[model samples]
Target: MTPDEPRSRLADLGVGPGAFTRGRHNAITDVSGVLVGHSTVHTDRLHTGVTAIVPAELGAERRWLPAGLAVGNGYGKLVGATQLQELGAVETPVLLTSTLSVYRVADALLGHMLEQPGYERTTTLNPVVGETNDGFLSDIRSRPLGDAHVSEALTAAAGGRVAEGSVGAGAGTVALGFKGGIGTSSREVPVGDGRYTIGALVQSNFSGTLSIAGVPMPADELVSAPPAETVGNSCMIVVATDAPLDARQLTRCARRAIFALRGVGSDFSQGSGDYAIAFSVGNGMPPADATLSPLLHATLDAVEEALINSILMATTQVHADGNRAHAIPLAAVHSRLAAAGVI
Candidate 1:
């Protein structure tokens, strides 16, 4: 889209992102010190790539950040998970990529981290890598993804507006029976001492009845156009905040955020491996009861909107092999939401 042209995002279409104040960039990167980057492989040979989230600057002294993992379903590969769970900290950048490339990305991440200024004697480093299958529209067996793509993503990661939809790990992903990909949003909530921010990034590839603000799509249309078995299979959600919290608290926050998926009509199919990972970067005390409630609510709003953004921002793409994924029609969604008085 051109600078003078309008983009098709939920807010632009009058869809709500919940009852919270948005961050400056209205993205996950709005959280302090968080940076995002993507490397999209769109050639005929490869329709996949990587999206990287750098919690802190690569050369920053504080390499580790407090984090937690919430497994909505345990049916996919997530490297560094074991150590992350055991230590409740993440020392390296988080990488999101296609399912089969998780290993290669992890290997690349390790190499990248080791080369950092202070990792000279580091014998072991945990690289957080999450993924979802994108083999339906793209040729997965090609294995075209590699360290170079990882390097590119990591190299460009920066704190600002994150590029969304049909990019990086979400390049070939399908969601809610439509084109789904990388999406992000952020919100600011009031805490006891002050305010904290909650940001979300989603890789949506799961399918179910399509609903927006409790208005389900015409049941007949969904039945007639059921989700292609090869797509709409899983999702990866990442939550970031500048608040001070340990892994356990973040895990709880992640669990609470999953409800947003249900609000958007996710059936959590057997093949849909829904996972949410949360982390905090600041040094303040944990949020109080009142503050946590609003934070959780705002997170749900951000997650729901982010997931929708993934679909809205993507464009319908046809693969060389003839497979195709259609983008959700934004004009149609706006009309429906308006009729239901949800906008």
Candidate 2:
């Protein structure tokens, strides 16, 4: 937000938007200890790839954490979620890719892990994978995701900057009649009795409907053209926190992401596959202990912040396919808000 914007143009915070509380960078990388990597593929016939999210304790091997998943729509494929849920732990990186390419990424992930000097020799590994449909701009039939791309994503995973819009798996994604791709945001809540941070990242390829805090606004009122149909859009949300929480508590945090999603006008359409995964650093909880109240509150604050961040800093991205999906154009959106006396 400190960056200067052209007087004639408004900044794109995410899918459909006007303004919300945003971090200094307004990106998922704003979350402490969260790293993001993108493998973008653009060729004569390819416009999709993968994104890897690493929530490690600065990439240390001994840093174990609790994790959980929530599947809003099961129409899409997700790998390793069962294990993550069963064990309440996520020891590996999470990869997001196009539909029909889950197995390829999973296998590549395994290989990537083994390639590490003491990978399997030290411990068994399990990778988390999530995806959405990209058949519109990509040759989804070709199954373009391969080992090289997956490996690149893993190797490139690092904390700091995260590229959004029309990159990685979002390169071929469409939302709300316009070109929609990746978006991210973060929120900070007082840790308790107060301390710690919670953040969120979203591979938002969901449908476009105009809604402001639950009130529907016709797309035409904002953008010149609205997407044709709102069907088949999907979104993948990932929440990461340094707070200590168990698997069940993490799952609850992941569900909060849907609330912010609805604020941005997502109806969780028929063809949409909305899924969330939440992970937390151990904080002060002992690995052997099964119950801790202080650690539990940390997770609740994280879930709340993570969901809000997913909707804040996402800017609109236009794809090469000639599709332009704009998150409520800032100017029109602000004007509409003022007219409705909501701003």
Candidate 3:
């Protein structure tokens, strides 16, 4: 792997240095009240897990969190599109499971929510669930995940340092032909005349020709031999912020994650369905009732920073099947930057 800074978290990857800032942990948890949890299932045959992202606030009427969605490619599945599109808001936690396990995970999430004291009284429920393929090293057809796993992940989540690399759903995945799974990063943006936080968590399963910032490199020289393309891959990006942005604006920010992914050498191949979702944990001040032009610009800035953090923070991983993928090295990256006159 390229020797950048021996970092396992995305924030340490070093992007747009000395300008935009980062949170304490350089994770989506930097956004106040955002909590993340994961349930990984790795056996002799199957390897996969479920990651749950809990927004600090819940319900359509709760005026603390505003959210948005961006779909780069629609070939994949997401459970809450209709409600999110209709009301421009989400009321439940965001869950990321394998492609075929969406329904089971969603049901489990809803059931888990009902068990909570405040959530049971609610009439309607909608849990946002996203997924990617992990069939390469995992026996996906086994449906390793169940209600208990989803509930455990959701209840166990808390805001703070989030573990990465094989700890969660990313456990059995691959990136650019190497072992890939979950990666996270964050950025602090100037807001209200000061700095506010925005961060991202990504399930990195996309494919490419294996380049660090578009500079093609030999595989064995850096990461282990690339994996066989059994199934086309995809990614699910979750952006979290304390900035007050409506759904449309949050979506605009979400799509910009592609820029950061590309900067890290992801080409968004044909089979890759790069999807992103953004949420604001700030007091969900209504757009209809409030007027602030400067806040909009601040929101945009946060989105860009948050997206870049996701890639810069991700590190390489090795899976149970004896397959390994290394993070793009920084030493080689420096040479490429100087050669391209980018430095």
Please tell me which predicted candidate would have the highest lDDT against the true structure. Answer: 1
lDDT of 1 at 277: 86
Task: Point out the higher-scoring one by lDDT: 2 or 3.
Answer: 3
Scored by TM-score, the top model is 1
Ranking by TM-score: 1, 3, 2
lDDT of each: 0.81, 0.63, 0.66
TM-score of each: 0.93, 0.79, 0.81
The residue-by-residue lDDT of candidate 3 on 102-151, one tens digit each, is 78888888787667676656777777898888777666787778798897
Model 1 lDDT, full chain set: 0.81
Model 2 Cα displacement at 247 (Å)? 1.4
Look at candidate 3 and tell me the lDDT of residue 5: 58
lDDT per residue as tens, model 2, 1-343: 0121221211242233222334455455666767888898866456688988876562345535788787887667778878888898887788899987878998898777667654546466777888888776667888989798987887787776566666776666665554456665554444444444566667766765645434455666555675533324777778876656678777767766655566566667777788888888646652323333433343333333333232223344333555334444455555665676665
Give candidate 1's total backbone clashes. 0
As for TM-score, the candidate ahead, 2 or 3, is 3
Q: Rank the candidates by lDDT, best first.
A: 1, 3, 2
For model 2, the superposed segments whose C-alpha errors exceed 4 Å read 1-22, 58-60, 122-124, 213-217, 226-231, 286-328, 341-343
**C-alpha positional error of residue 28 in candidate 1 after TM-score superposition, expressed in Å:** 0.2
